[model samples]
Each structure stands twice: as C-alpha cells, then as structure tokens.
Target: MRLIKPVEITPAKLISSNVPETDYPAWLVSATYALGDRVLLDHTIYEALAAVAAGVKPGEEVVTPEAPAKWQNRGMDNRWRMFDDKVESLTTNPGTIEVRIRPGAVINSMALFNLQGKSVTITMIDPVEGEVYRKTLTLVDAGVTNWYDWFFEPIGKRTDVVVLDMPPYGSADIVLIIDAGAELAAIGHTVIGAVKRIGTALYGTSVGINDYSRKSTDEFGNTIVVQRSFSNRAEFDVTLDTSEVTRVRRLLAELRATPVVWIGEESYEATILFGFYKDFQIVFSGPTVSDCSITVEGVI
Candidate 1:
C-alpha cells in the first residue's frame, strides 16, 4: 500500500478556477452585515444571527454592541468545498469544471473522491515546456456478473479515481478538468500529495461505509427512516520489508487522526481511502517481511 500525506492548499497555490461563488459574498470587516446575511470566511459560510457591526469578524466573538454572538457558521462554501477535507459536502458546478493549480512543491499523486463527472482530465504544463504530462480517466465501473446482468442492468459509475506516478514539478501549471456531459459536475474531495511507497497491497482488504442514518420501526410495524449523512470506512493490511519498521511507525504516528490518502491498489478505486486511521498494528513475524493493518474512519 502507498501512503500520501496531502499538502495544505492555499489561495496562492490554487491559482485559478472556472467556477465562481454566485450565492455567498466574501465577508468584509468594514461592512455592517444585517441579520440573516451570509458571507464566506476562510472557505466556510457563516450567517449573521444578529446585527453584525463593522470590524466584527464572522468567526470571532462579538464584543460590546454586537454582544449576543453575531455569526452562525452554516457550512463550507460551495466554491471551496473540495478543499474542505470533508466528504459529504461537494463542490458543484454545471457542465465541465476545471481548476488550475501551482502546487509550489513537488507532488506525484492526485485523487478525486465522490465526484459526479463521467470523465476526468489532468494535465501539467511547465514554464519552458508546453506540456509536461497529461492523462484522462473515466468513472464508469463494470459490475455485471453475467450475460443476463449485462443485458438487463444499466452501467454503474464510481465516485472516486486515483492518478499516480504523476511527474513532480514545483513550477508546473497543474490543471484538473472534469466533464459531466452537460450534467452537474460535483466533487467532494480532491487532493494532491507526494507518494510514499510503504508496502505491497495484499488480500483480505475490506471496503464499505458507516451508515449514520437513523432508522426505526413504528408501533404498527411500519418502518421509518430518517436519512442522514454516512461515511466510508476501510480495513486493509499491507506487507512490507521489516527493515523499514522504524520509519513506518514514525510515519503512522505523525499521520494519526490526520486526513491522508491510502491506496491499497492504484487501479482499484474501492481501495482508495482518503481519511484518518484510528488504530494500526504492525507485526514482524518472518525474517525479512512484516505485516501491518490499518482501520480508517471517513470524515463526514
């Protein structure tokens, strides 16, 4: 398995985007926002619960005049949802969506999760060279069990994709494009990270989700379900060289509870998890090989 510790994205690194914030406006310290007015601050949306006077920040506690607390944090801004590190809220736009980035550091791995795009294109262009790298990927997945299923059932699309072995260049213009075929293009999380080869992916790896939706049965034997958000979970084991035990342990300690990408297999999208692991244990049983298991919990 490969580990990818994602870099924190900033406005300077994210050079440009085709999508714009149409609903929410940026918060201004000098502007007096009335009650019920929503504004974007630090990639999050906040609404004024009471009268917000000048110099009162959205996330800060209100003083004297604006005393009873002024702002109510609603959620992440739609334009910046993909960078929020949360999988439930998505950055959506009509038609094709594209983002231009200058990582400002070396990165060789990129992944997209919970996307609604049919096809995706990623490219890198250098200052001197016209195009350094380019690749296009599709989201369709084959699940037909037999001829009957293939002829009767419709094709299904996966929500995630991983691109590895990307050419690393700090000054290159990295562009991400997603085409939804005139439909809405939505992406929940997109990350660019430097790949760290840890071990080889093995079998017995499991992938699924933790359903948080409340469900109950009524007194009359009626089933009632309150739909709520859910999160993905994965448990995977990897086999690695026993010599790298110290480095692996240190890396795991550093990345504990921090959101990072774990790829069990590059081609298997189901094994690609972008979340935090709760606990991990490594066992050195043989002479030159070791085994490690990680249980990851997704961010909702």
Candidate 2:
C-alpha cells in the first residue's frame, strides 16, 4: 500500500493566524502606538489606552494604562481614556502629557507601545462589553522602534478578521476504502486495499486554447485564454479473495454514481475511473486469489 505524508512543514510565504478566527498580525512591543490605534489580539480589538511614549514598553506593572490613575473606561458616557503623562518623559512620578484629550474630546482610537525587551502576551479588555482580546508579540528588541496603526471602528464593530489560505501542496497519503453500509463487525469488511500512487502537486486549475497556431494572430479570436478545471490522477492496488473480488468490482462500479472520494480523513469532490482492472482475473489457488489495480481521475 502507498500513502503520502508530510516530511516537514516548510516555511512558505503563507502565514496563518494563531489567533482564533482572525488574521490580524500578532502585536509587537518595540512598536509605537498613539491615541485611537487599534489592534486585534486574542479575538478582540484593543484601542490604545493613551498615546504611548516614544520609548515605553507595554505589559509593565510599573507603567500600565490602568483605570482612574493611568486609564479610564466610563460606561455612563461610552468613553474609555488613559491619562499617563509621566510615561512620555520617562518620569517615575505621576505627570501629565499636555496633548491628552479632555472629557469632551471625541474619542477616536487607541495605541499601544512595547517597552518590554522580549515578546509578551497581553489581553485588552473591552470597556463597554468587558470582552477580552489576547495576543502575543515577537521580541521587540531592547528599545522602542517598532510601530503599528489602527483606526477605530464604529461603537459596536468587531476587529478586522481574515480567513486562512489553502496549503500549497498535497500529501501522498494512502487512500482507505470503508464499507459505508456495514454494521459493526468482529473482524471487518471482506476486502481491504489502499491507493498506491497519486499526483504529487497540489490541487489546481488549468487553461486551454481552441487553436494552437494562433500565436500572435491579430484577430480577437486568436488571443483569448480559456480557463479549465484541474484534474488529478490516482492509482490503487489490492489483493482480494475470489468472493471479495466481486464485491470490490461492485464498489468500483458504484463509485461512478458518486460525486466524492475519500482519501484518508480528507474528502475531495471528484470523479473516479476504473479502466485499469475492470476485467481483473482471479487465480484458483488454495484460497482463490485475485489481484486488482484501479485507476482514478479526479477533478479538484
């Protein structure tokens, strides 16, 4: 039996979000953020509590955007603000940044700055609904040089979300055939087999042309590109008993009417072909032996 498996997970240009259901890049600490900046973390968007200083780090117990002292979240007026003036001047005592917005200023966004020397995970609490967004950041060097920007969404809007991309390649795993109609059995089905070979490349599409010699012909019909669906080929080999050979042939015949094929745990919407062993021969040995090889053509 032949099967395909991933030898190594190559680091391709493709990136996946570790965050659940969102593609927002992980937050960074070396970066600088100002008022109204937005970041997606731990399935939530955190606005900068205050305009982070040029060299301040986030997640610091000593330098935090807390309520009443450094940060404020007011539910009665739907306003969340942070007041940390000492952070900008690197001062230990409480001070005020003159640019701080007052109570009547229309709150537009939030920002975060990473002063931590290494990567850190932090959670942002939603001022209104109390929802928590968490995410991790890469090491931000020892100083403050990195920065990110985020505009505020509407009052009730969620953070930016994105879907993951498909894998660039397919594995070479063996295909398993199961009896979909059988009850629990002490042993199992009378026949068992696996696919031996399949296409090495990932699923993809192709294009076609009606004329081959139309290369650079000036006419409109000569320079058109036709799109076509992609196809993948597979081969299966199995040994069976004479009685099981008939059942296997019957199963192959039934596949013609089915629209999907199962290759291990993954299912592909495909079409099957059995031209290779439709008329397989059974040898009469001690236990009537039959060998069958089946070919399949699938549309990906």
Candidate 3:
C-alpha cells in the first residue's frame, strides 16, 4: 500500500505587537489582545501535530471539524457531545473554564474512544476590567486517549455526527473521545496514501521590439509562463507492512508535484482515519527542521 500523509498547520506568525492600553476599556483591550494571540498559537500547534500524525508535511492546511463525510448521518439523535458543543461564558477566574452539557442530550451508546490528551486551557483576563475569556484547551501530549470517549458499530453501519461549536470571544474546553464496538472501526486508522503542496506564479518580463514595415505595430507582447514553487516540507508514516515503505516514498514524490488550490488565509481542521492499525512509520523533511513528534498514549 502507498504511504499516507498526515494533515498539518503552520505556526502563528505575530501580526501585531506592543500597543498602548489607553485606546479602549482596560479589560476589553487586554482580553482582546491576549485571546487573539492565544487563538492563533493554539490553531498553529493543532495543525502541526495533526499533520504529523497523518504523516503529512508540517505546513499543510486543514479545516477543523468533528468528522469526515461518511460519519455525518450516523443515528446518534443529536445528543450534546461534550467536546462537540461550543461554550461561552464571562467570569473572573482564570483557573479553568468549564461547561456542563444538559445531561442525556448525548447517547452514551454512541460514544467512542478518546483520541487526544488533557485540554490546554488558555485563560485571558483583564485585570483592570475583571473580564475573562477561555477557549478550546490544548493537549500536552499527542495521541492521549484519556481525555475523550469513543463509540462505534460494525462496518457498513452508519454513525451520528456530533455538532460542536465555540462562541466568538468565548472559552471552550473539549475532550477527545470515541465510540467503539464490533464492526465499528476507529476513524483514525485509515492511512493517508500521499499528500503534496503546490503553488504557481508569473515567470519573466516582456521586451519591446520595433517593426520595420510602415504598417508595423509595437512587438511588446509579454511572454507569460507558469512558474511553480513547492514546500520543502514532507512527511510519511508506516502502516500495513514494512514493504509498504517503498510505495509510500513514491506516493510522496507524486503528491509533491500535484496542483493545489490556493485558499488564501483561513483556518481548517482535518481528521484522518487509520482503519484498525496501530503501529505506524513516519518521516518528514523541509527547509526548517520541524518541532514535530508523535504521541501514542491516550492523554496529552
């Protein structure tokens, strides 16, 4: 089988720095600035680890959501999944941000295994104004399953999709969990065969030439050609068997040359299904060595 690449996210680059606090209410200004920076950082780290887990490059962009297309129609009855719900609250405590689901809205039978670790809590408080906000907590380790619960069913059977959202400028803490059963496959087991990043640009400038004839027109037409650039970063993981290594390498080369659409500026979460296999082989390379690693445990 070909090697599968994981999804990835880039580090958040600082967009703004030091500013005077006099522009707005002390609490509002502090909260906005702190939360904005935290959001960007958390997003960047999530993408990076997610991509590494999938065995893809570190800079690949992926949208963040609960599941893939196949799981959208499962019959869970729209229960309130803990991590799937978006939470918002205003308080003064920066210790922990918590939310309670109106118990029973979620079907316990449908729960699955927890895939990640302890949530990373980001607390933004305006000391002057006494306003505070929190967001989806970050996990310390990769592949920590302790933080979530999972549920599953047999193959060819349908599963329900949990609809979760986070309120703007609000705090959210999510735990990763899964539902497993006979015939139910862990969604992360499906391997990514290959992944690539691509971009294009204009090549050279045009030159002007004079025509000899009286009916001559200026010969200044531009010679435009397509120029391409590729990310130096790439990654791969071993699954299925060791012989699959060569095939995975070839797949990586192919992905490097594939064309990709430019989405401009956006944030996305991507999930990969690994289909019942545990042991995996991964490799990565790029202009800058990535701070990437794998987490096999259930808790971060």
Best by TM-score: 1
Off by over 4 Å in 2: 1-227, 262-286
Question: lDDT for model 2, on a 0 to 1 scale?
Answer: 0.28
Candidate 3 residues lying further than 4 Å off, grouped into runs, are: 7-177, 180-300
Give every collision pair in model 1. Answer: 1-199
Measured against the true structure, the TM-scores of the candidates, in listed sequence, are 0.92, 0.22, 0.15
Off by over 4 Å in 1: 28-31, 62-66, 142-147, 218-220
Report the lDDT tens digits of candidate 2 across residue range 1-300.
212211221123112211133323334656677676555433333456677554443333264345322222221100111112111111111111111111121111122211212222333233343423344433322233334222332222111111111112122111111111232101100111123222221333221212323234355666645554333445444455666655555555654533222231122212221112223223333366655554444322
Ranking by lDDT: 1, 2, 3
**2 against 3, candidate with superior lDDT:** 2
Instruction: Decide which is better by lDDT, 1 or 3.
Output: 1
Measured by lDDT, the strongest candidate is 1
Q: What is the C-alpha RMSD of each candidate to the true structure, in Å?
A: 2.2, 26.8, 25.4
Reference-based lDDT, each prediction: 0.86, 0.28, 0.23
For model 1, residues 26-84, the per-residue Cα lDDT tens digits are: 88878999889998888789999878789888777745764577888888777788888
